[model samples]
Target: MHGPVSTAWSLVALCAATGAYCLLRMRSGVEEQRRAAGGEALMGFGMAVMAVPAAVYAPPRWAWPVYAAVFGAAALRALWSARAGAHHLHHAVGAAAMVYMSVAMAAAPTAHHAHGAPGVPPVTGALLVYFMGYVLLSGARLVPAAVPAAGTGSGGARARWGDRPELARACRLSMGIGMVAMLLAM
Candidate 1:
């Protein structure tokens, strides 16, 4: 494979591995952790599908509609569960982005072209920017904050990173950087 295609495949592998790890973490015995892991697994798997190089496998014309329909359903589910939390909102946005990308790919003049090129259309560029920003911000939020011991309660209950696990944070950062690379490759 060429450089961009190879890189995209590498990112897809990383996403798959992250998804596996998240799935394993589901047994961590913490309800919040399980929920977070479940979400991460879904995100990772979805990203892997999105990151696949066109050279390897570009979805057929009919497949685009199917992909859009699947993601549309996911978006609808997310919308229905909007009251769940910010993660659900993010999932909804992700599903919508997938649907948009699938439709755009179907409509592209050279839909069968290789995955990464030097010039991406303005709309794809905008979407890349949005995803890059979201990934970076979300990763940053996963970082553990430092708190003084004095700030702890009388029982020494220290602040933590909450439901965000270290591996999950690393995965987010990896995907964020991967998105940047993909954007540059375009």
Candidate 2:
């Protein structure tokens, strides 16, 4: 693979490894932590597939529809679980983005269908920008901030920025940057 593709793959591997670690951590955590771990794992794996180099394996024509269908179902599930939290809404958006990317790939002419190619439509470019912003901001929000020692309760545990594990947050930030790079390559 070329430099850009190699970088993308490296990011993908990092994301996947982080996700796997989160899953492993889940074995001893609370219900919320377990849920977050599962979500991270799925996100990592899905992005890895999406971020794969086109030269290695562009999705077959039929696979595009399958990808759309799968992500569409995920979106529906997210919608149904909207009561869970804002994270579910994020999941819905991610699923929708995947569906959109699938359709865009399927609809593009074969000559221009390769990933990160110049012939991509304006809509895809717009989506990439939007996704880049969303992922970056979301990931940033996950980063933990230092709190005063006195702020801790009797248990003396430092508060986390959010429910997600630190590694998960790092994974997200990594993916966010990776997505930006992928968009720029387009």
Candidate 3:
């Protein structure tokens, strides 16, 4: 069965807000933070558009292909960036998941919408498992730990807004949860 309209609207709001925050984050002086924020913002906005309920706005036929192409490029870029660090590999996987979902939706829009559509495909299942693990791990990181304030040696009280690691992590957590919801809907 299709999800409630309110759920779709909530997702839209959440994603859009996350995107906005990421855009602000891109203003950070750190080059890497700006780059990462840019990518996260794109993903947030793209997910927001994809998550829009079909009943509210039926996308044009060409939209899914466009989604696939955009995310595919992102996936490739993430893969190329992966050599610098392991996190880029995660980004590549996330982008690839978006591509997979877009391709599936395009291949059989009707089937996806149909209650009798074939049971969860293996790829979707794998992505779900991966994202669930990410969500849990991110959630765990949010917990307040009793660690010493070593960060005090850095930008103490005058830290830039975009440099807040806690907020950035929260934004990632929001997007991860959004991904799970969108994948489940698919």
Q: Which candidate leads the pack in TM-score?
A: 3
**What's the ranking of the predictions by TM-score, best on top?**
3, 2, 1
Task: Write the residue-wise lDDT of candidate 2 on 98-186 in tens digits.
Answer: 68767766775663555674565686577677778877686767755765466566587744534435655676566556555555554
All models: lDDT? 0.69, 0.66, 0.87
Which structure among the candidates has the greatest lDDT?
3
Clashing pairs in 3: none
Summarize candidate 3's per-residue lDDT along 77-113 as a digit string, tens digits.
9999999988888889889999998888787657645
lDDT of 1 by residue, 19-116 (tens): 77778777775876776667667767766776788788876678778878888888887777678776677667766766776676576647557576
Give lDDT for model 2.
0.66
Off by over 4 Å in 3: 110-118, 147-155
Which wins on TM-score, candidate 2 or candidate 3?
3
lDDT of 2 at 122: 80
TM accuracy, model 2: 0.71
The residue pairs in collision within model 1 are 117-186
